[model samples]
Target: MKCTAVLAALAAIAITPVNGGPIAYGICQTGCNAVVVACYAAAGFQFGTVIAAAAAPATILACNAALGTCSATCATVALFAPIP
Candidate 1:
């Protein structure tokens, strides 16, 4: 009986749509590495790509502000800046 219930729960999770996406939690500047880690874990499988994509606009804006010499690496650094 217990095994059946556990299996049912697992099946429910397996079928659930992943909608949470990338979730940015807490303040990075204040050093919420733990929270950031937790949020990334909870953000689920595709978060790496989702997060990068979501952060793209801000990165572009910063790049433009800097006079059009934006490298993705540089933009990414600012995109996830602790104090930004």
Candidate 2:
């Protein structure tokens, strides 16, 4: 039993890649969401609303790119998973 507990503790330490905690996860998601909202607002589009690439301004495209990068980073660090 004691050996199993020691192994579990070691595993936990081995996996934490950053200052992993609830606060970090919340901050990561909040920041990512803010970027998306700001981008959408700038383009005169709100959340859940989509516009065609050809019709939308360059800001929309840049927003999408930023969102992708943000999501990937958050998942890898905070969630400990890939954006699959």
Candidate 3:
């Protein structure tokens, strides 16, 4: 059991940034919102509303590219799994 715990800890460390770096929001998150709004803006929602919905929090897991892999700092492990 102890060995398993140690291995889990090591894996966690391996995915983390050395000093807790900042991450940028994925472009897809923004782009999807833009496209949706552009396609349906006449339905009552304004461009600003779409922009507001697309706006990410001040702090978010920024996507980073590293040696053919994605290395990112995020609030949750699940957040790090997907590239976008």
Residue-level lDDT tens digits of model 2 in 1-84: 122233335446664444445554565677788879888897888855775768667888788888878766665565532111
Q: Candidates' TM-scores?
A: 0.21, 0.55, 0.24
Task: Go through the candidates in order and give the clash count of each.
Answer: 1, 0, 2
* Predicted model with the maximum TM-score: 2
Q: Sort by TM-score, best first.
A: 2, 3, 1
lDDT of 3 by residue, 1-84 (tens): 122233345446665453321222243233334444443543444434334434533221121121012212222332333221
Q: Which ten residues in a row have the lowest lDDT in candidate 2?
A: 1-10
Task: Give each model's whole-structure lDDT.
Answer: 0.33, 0.62, 0.32
lDDT tens per residue, model 1, 26-81: 22112333333344445442223434544555543343333222233223333333
The 10 consecutive residues of candidate 1 with the worst lDDT sum are 21-30
Residue pairs with colliding backbones in model 2 are: none
Supply the TM-score for candidate 2.
0.55
